[model samples]
Target: MCTKFYDSEFSFLISTTEIGNSQIIYEEFWFYTEFVNIFFQNTTLQEKEKERKIENVIKERKEIVIKERKEEKERTERKEKEGNGKERTERREKENLVLYKFLLEQLMNQRQKRNTPNNPRKNKIKRNENFAQKENEGSSSEEESNQFETQFQELVDSLMDSNSITRCEKYAELNHNISHYYLPIIGDFFDDTLLAVKNSLKKGSVEEQVLAIRCLLLFSITLEDAADEIFNQFEPLLLKYSLEGQNKLKIASIEALGILSYFITNTGDLDSSQKILRHCISILKNNFIPQNGGHEIYIAKVLNMCSLLLSLQANDFIGIELSGNNESDGGIFFEYIVNIGKSFLEYPDLDVRISSGRLITLAFNLKDRLEREEVVDSDIDVDAIVEIFNKLMKEYSQKVSKKTKTKQRAEFKQYISSIEECIYPKDLITIKSNKIHLEEWPKIIQLNIIRNFLGSGFQKHIEKNFLFSQLFGYRIKVESHRQKHYNKKSQRKEQKKNKKYRQQNITKERKKKNNFENQFM
Candidate 1:
């Protein structure tokens, strides 16, 4: 509290000092001018002038302190020699410490200087010196760490200068290297990269910023066993991105949070992680239908990423609800499912609206559970939802006129059914782009991802839908018989046509064989 108060008050104190000095300097400079004798000649008192000079000097000292503070903020290489003055200030640090790590070291150093320096006990001191020597060997390790960090930064900046595919591949190699030799140091790498990301973001290069983010994301792979530690400084970078990064960066930042929340498999407690996600969910929801059309794609895309993460997070949080009623349960896992569905089924952009089967199943299950919780079991029917889905599929069926471009129809259908194991209701298509038609949509290949995953009733529910239905299903026996019958008829017709063509060619080729035989006879 006191620190915050001091910081706040100090800002105003400096502001006042700066303004006062400016006025005094102006007044003094004018004292010897032509206007001095005009109207303000003897009005200026000597004591006031003297007071102004003193204020000016104090203000200059204050200004110097301000400049030094800015300089100090940049110099975190750590002090080999103590008590660096304004004259000895550096333009940049050889290595910027992880701010938390720096704080810990500072605390240790301050304790050593104030208390340990005075301790006496000559024999004990010698013994302690040997131990301290070994402990302080961290200086050498720290040196190597700093050097490696600098080289890595240079490598990254240079790699970023190359074309994107090369940059991505280079990043992949570096990431693999960290995984091999420097696993323990990966967390600090993420922290340092935050600075570069901030710089790129400020420069307004969205591509550079996102690429930097992906580089930072590579650290996630090494964090497999020690993923919890990844959370230490993640929120700050994510918050910075949310506040200042471009659209892609913001989405990437949210995805990072999702990675943290869900990646840990079984992180003991997830309540803290959940708080950060609420705002993200809100953002996803709000951006569902953007004012202009194409903007909706970005919204859906971000939501798609967000939903997968949320599902994983919620799964971790719910952790097998034992009670009969986990009404608001499955934690973020269930919420994630619905939000994902919201993106694919509810959002404006057709291309961004689908996910692979497993995710779709997860989302559909979430909607089912959420709906079932408030309704009577009879009234809440999966089949009805399926019917609605079929309707949506029909809506998505996209009827293209025969004149439509064959290539475009194929492309549109592929987009509609991009995710395998996706299922839709009896509709031929579910969504449409401005230039696309309905018949080109892929049939919703139902995968029953949730039921296949959960087993028991889920399987039954999904399988039952697939097995029955007159207007919507293809019966195996009937389809097979029809195919065989068509094959036989087509083969006979082809053979007949071949024989007739051969006979006509032979008739035209030579009547000479017959004429010669008749003459000889």
Candidate 2:
């Protein structure tokens, strides 16, 4: 009975312990499962948060980039708009300057009329007016010129303003005065005036364009700085207008360019002077040809300018004539100019021919001056030049002889004399084969006889003939005996006239004696 009771108690103890152990195991398993679920949920929330932040950062960057691009685009557009505004302002300023030029011109014209006093009655009536009144009138005229000059300054200064005045005749007149007068005095305002003038050249009226160019030319002479600026800006314009503009415009542009060349030469810039010379030559070569729209008046105008340029005083201040070593085209420009002048002599237009003739004369004079300065070598083709010169002289000499009216003859004679001066005496001597004996002959005999005796020296004879032919045209040589016979004939005629006069005197005395004897009887 005791053993059975012990076994039951042990079984009951074992069963209770097992139940406690199983409960502990079940609770721990559930606790671990809950912890895992909580940890996974926290990880998922963190991942989602990280993804949202990344998306927000990316969107912010995109917004910043877009904002920068928009700002840059706006800045570019603003700059472009400002540029356009400035261009418009410049355009308006140029237009207003033109209007002011016209106004100044009218004032000048009115003052000129008042000063001239066209009515004789008014002048007579005014003559008895007070001397003080006359002085006052002169003073008033002076004041008007001063006033116009002042008005011109105002117009040029207006170029700097953003707002310009209304366009009118007064503006045009002022532009004219600025070019014609004010620019010569002050020569300032090149920058403003240059732009205005350029605008005028491009789109202004014919008168306006001419006035603008005239102003620039005056400005160039008044100031060296202005000259440099003028050449840089207006050189192209000069070529353009000369080729494309009307006759007046073309002529005006050529004059302006000629003035520019004078200024350029004064600076002693050989390269620049050469460029101008080349350009002028090219213009003559290209445009003066029949195939290239050659105009007689235009060609004549260009020839005149070329002559002026070739004869520029290379050293005006010092009075030192240009030498072979001189900085201005090395003194060789005269040759090129002479060649051009020679070409123009054969031009179809008579005006062109006359213009070329004048140019040739000036060129020859320049060459001689340089030679006198000993600037040129003696190796020059004096023969060829003399040949050309002789032909030119022959033509003019014939013209003089053929002319009937004194005025016409005088004109041709003047031309002939001018050309005769250009012939180098040395050239004639050289053509005479350096024959010193030829100088001993009488002036007229030398011309008529020595010229023929210069055989195989046709060019020399032509020059010799031309030199003496100014007084007499196309002289023919007389045979030695014939010349002597003519001299005897002239002597015989003089003797016969003297004999007749003596006989008449004797007969008158005899009649007087007879009258006295009859009175006595």
The C-alpha stretches of model 1 lying farther than 4 A from their native spots are 1-204, 225-230, 236-245, 313-348, 356-360, 363-381, 392-521
Count clashing pairs, candidate 1: 21
Model 1, 178-288: lDDT tens per residue?
432323344435444555445544553566556555555445433332335555545676666753445677766665655555434334556535555555555655555
Predicted candidate 2 versus true structure: per-residue lDDT over 1-521, tens digit per residue: 11112234223211223553777557755765676688799999999999999999999999999999999999999999999889967855664554445445545655655696778998776556745675766665556556645655676765434433332233444444433332323443456677777776776778767767766765554343466668877788787787776877988887677667655765665445545555567788666775555477778777766655655543331222333234344245555556677777666556677667666655555555566776654334645655654564456444343433343333334445544554322213332233322321112222432233223433423433222232223443443433554465467569979999999999999999999999999
lDDT of each: 0.46, 0.56
TM-score of every model versus the real structure:
0.37, 0.42
Relative to the true structure, candidate 1 has a C-alpha RMSD (angstroms) of 35.7
Best by TM-score: 2
Q: Which stretches of candidate 2 lie over 4 Å from their true place?
A: 1-150, 153-172, 175-191, 205-207, 222-225, 244-247, 291-294, 313-335, 373-521
